[model samples]
Target: MAPKAQTPSKGSKKAVTKTSKGSTAGKTEKKHKRRRKETYSIYIYKVLKQVHPDTGISSKAMSIMNSFVNDIFERIAAEASRLSHYN
Candidate 1:
C-alpha cells in the first residue's frame, strides 16, 4: 500500500531548516590559529675532578652561562613579537 503525497496545494519549494548542532568543519581551522608553547634551550657542563670527585662545575661559570642564555631568550622573544605584528 503506497501513501499519497499531502502537498500544500502543490508547486511550493521545500523549506530547509538550519541544523541545530551547527557545522563542525570550521573548528579545526580555529585550533590551527592557536599559539604554540614557548621554546627554550639549556646547556649543562659536567666535569668530574679526580682530587675532589664530588666537585661539579664552577659556580662563576654557571652564573655567566645562565646570563648568556637569558640574553638569547630575550632576543628570541623580541623577534617573536616582531613576527607576530607582521602576521
Candidate 2:
C-alpha cells in the first residue's frame, strides 16, 4: 500500500507558500539622475595636436570645426529621438 501525503491544517504556518509572481509591496522605486554629456571638441583638439605637433590650428578654424561637429551631432540625436518615438 502507498503512504498517504499529509495536508497542512488551516492554522499551520507551513500552509503559506511563496508566489511565482513576486510581491513588491514595501519597496520604493528609485529615479536615476541624468548625467551631463561633455562636448567632443576636447578630444578632437587632442587628435589634431597629435597628428600635427608642429602645425597649429587657428582659433577661428577650431571654432568652425566645433560648430560643424555640434550640428551633425544634433541632427543625429534628433533622428534617433524621432525613430524611438515612432517605435
The prediction achieving the highest lDDT against the true structure is 2
Output the TM-score of candidate 2: 0.49
For residues 1-87, write the lDDT of model 1, one tens digit per residue: 123355642423332222322245444444356787432222344323445667576677677766777788889999999999997
Candidate 1 runs further than 4 Å off? 1-56
**Each model's C-alpha lDDT?**
0.55, 0.70
- TM-score list, all predictions: 0.38, 0.49
Error of 1 at 31 (Å): 45
* Candidate 2 lDDT by residue in tens digits, 1-80: 22333334432444343222223322544446799876666777898889987777878887788888999999999999
- Judged by whole-model lDDT over C-alpha atoms, candidate 2 comes out at 0.70
TM-score of 1: 0.38
